[model samples]
Target: MKFFDELKARGIIDALSNEEELEKKFNEGGMSFYCGYDPTARSLQLGNLFTIITCMRFQKAGHKPYMLVGGATGMIGDPSGKSEERNLLDMETLKENIDAIRKQLGLFVDFECGDNAAVLVNNADWWQGLGFLEFLRTIGKRFRVNEMLNKDSVKSRIESDSGISLTEFSYQVLQAYDFVTLNKLHNVSLQIGGSDQWGNMTAGTDLTRKMNQNQVYCMTMPLVTDQNGKKFGKSAGNAVFLDGSMTSPYKMYQFLLNQDDAIIDALLKYYTFLSLDEIAELDSKTKNEPHLRLAQKSLAQEVTKLVHGQEGLDAALRATQFFFGEKIENVSDADVASIFEDTPSVELSSEMLNEGGVIDMLSETPLFKSKKEVRRAIDQKGIYINNVAIEGPTQTLSKADLASETALVLRKGKKNYCVVKFK
Candidate 1:
């Protein structure tokens, strides 16, 4: 399929400037395109993955992808989607964030693919040297104050309690200059970003045209959200980060796997490269047998494998299976710790276990309300020690019951599990 056609098919292109000219340029091939990522944090979150995927799609189509880390702009945050001003990061923190983000981008895009190898550029390289007066004369002169005031980002902030700052108000000018610089340095003519970045992106195209007297292109993908309209990249008020250190592969898998059925089709389009036929099949399964969660599992697997590789996906699957009645004997200690990281846990001294049977131990922890509740659950065949049903209150955790040498899995029922770590 043609590049634009594929983008439309995948629901990646929300809006683009001068589609006819861009299509012609794309058909000719070897077009260098870029998407900017601000290092506001140490790692890119799930929210940033769509743009990265878009870059990958362009690269696969034989276009050169430039992943721009916004070291210059990140210092003065983009006010695109925020209701309030962002706290500026110190230079040291911004540099650390840039280095970390650079490493994460390396995992997704090929940096050594011969001719079309992806390139990483820091906007700081050029912006750092440019003087304020020079910037005002050269780039800032192109932007009209009235036009900047009319932009959605600027207009909304101007009407709000916390009005926009001069630093942030001039952010569009800096971003526009980025496109101009890339065009001059790398022959890059296309810029892609999220729908929220439409104004900033078009400003870049405008600046390029005004400066070089040459037309450029800009495209944006829709912002992805869950069924309830919350953005897809967050869980329990925290971002689901792409860096494993920030958010573990198992947690990432579970987050995707537990998405509402109503949004799975859209997520399939936005997140995965699964073809229309495959996604259609999964959609059909979702309709016919929602209980199977075929779509959710596929979404989780595809995203997890993409971000964390096969081994990480395997670990996620193993961790998930272990909780759903799978035997715990084969799982490693590290796997056990990872799987139950969010589940309730109780730590007991080795000497404490010697003083009590299973019921007595259960009573001591928050797992059970009382000794009576423990006995009741045990009698009802709802209590399990390491996936084996505890027959009576007489049953005690023996050393052999420990999955590792130090831990035991306790289950009150099918879904509820707690880890008892013997210190």
Candidate 2:
């Protein structure tokens, strides 16, 4: 398949301005393209993953990709898809966010691929030195206030209760000037963004044509949403950040693993580099045997590997298996802690274990409500110590039973589990 054809086949293109011309340019090859990311947060969230992957796809097709960090524009937030004006970040926070995001982008794009290697550029480098008068006479003269007001980003905000701020209202103009600057400095001819960025992206193309008389292009990918129409990349109102410290690899894997089956096929298209035939095969299996969750597992594995690398994927798998009757006898203390990080836990002094056995321990902790409940659970063979079924309530917890001499794994029936840490 041709490069552009593959992009369309994978459902990556939401809308492209001047498709015929862009298609010709793509076929000729060696076009430089850019996607802008604002430093609004400490890490790029799952919402940003699709654009990064698109850049990777373009780079693999022999095009140079520019990862543009909006250091200047981030200080004045973009109003697209926002309900109200965003809080401005101080210079310290913006710089920290830019540095962190640059590192994360490196994981996705090849920075050493010779000519086509991805380049990281910050808008602040150009915007910082321009005086207000120069900016007004040069870039500002090209924009009309009436046209700016017609933009969806501005129109929606103007009608809202909070209204629009002049700072945010001029964001499209800044983004437009970025295109002109990139065109002049890097010969960048294409800009890619999310569907919500359609207005801002078109503004850039327009400014580029008016200023440089160059035909630059803009393409957008559809905003990802779940079966319920909720956007992806959020968990409990907080975004799923790319940084492992912000959103753990284990948690990211679980989030993908738990995706609704109804949305898995579409998600596979957006999230993975798997071939269409491979995805089709997985889709068939999903329909035939939904219980196995073949598609969901593959999506989790592929995306987790992309974001966190192979070792992170392995850790996520290990964390997952820990709950599914996996043996805990040889598990490391840190691994055990990570696996049960979200599970119920009780810390007990080392001396408590010597007073009695497993029965005495359960009677004291909240794992069991009362001694009678503990006895009942043991009688039904529903209790496990270190993943080994307890013979009865009398079966004692010796030092030998502790995994890594730090913790004991206790389970009730098939799903519920708790960790007992010895201090």
Give a tens-digit lDDT track for model 1, residues 119-181: 999999999999989988888788899999988988999999999999999899889999999
Q: Which stretches of candidate 2 lie over 4 Å from their true place?
A: 234-238, 329-342, 347-356, 391-408, 421-423
Give the per-residue lDDT of model 2 (tens digit) for 1-423: 788887888889999999998887776679999999999888888878988998988898889999999999999999988878888999999999999889989989998999998899999999999999999998998889999999998999999999999999999999999999999999999999999899999999999999999989999999887666766543325467888877778888988888899889878988899998999999999999999999999999999999989988987897787677877776667666656777888888787666357777887776788989999998999988877898876676667878766888888889888889888
- Model 1's alpha-carbon lDDT is 0.86
For each candidate, give its TM-score against the true structure: 0.92, 0.91
Candidate 2 lDDT for residue 400 = 80
Q: Which candidate tops TM-score? A: 1
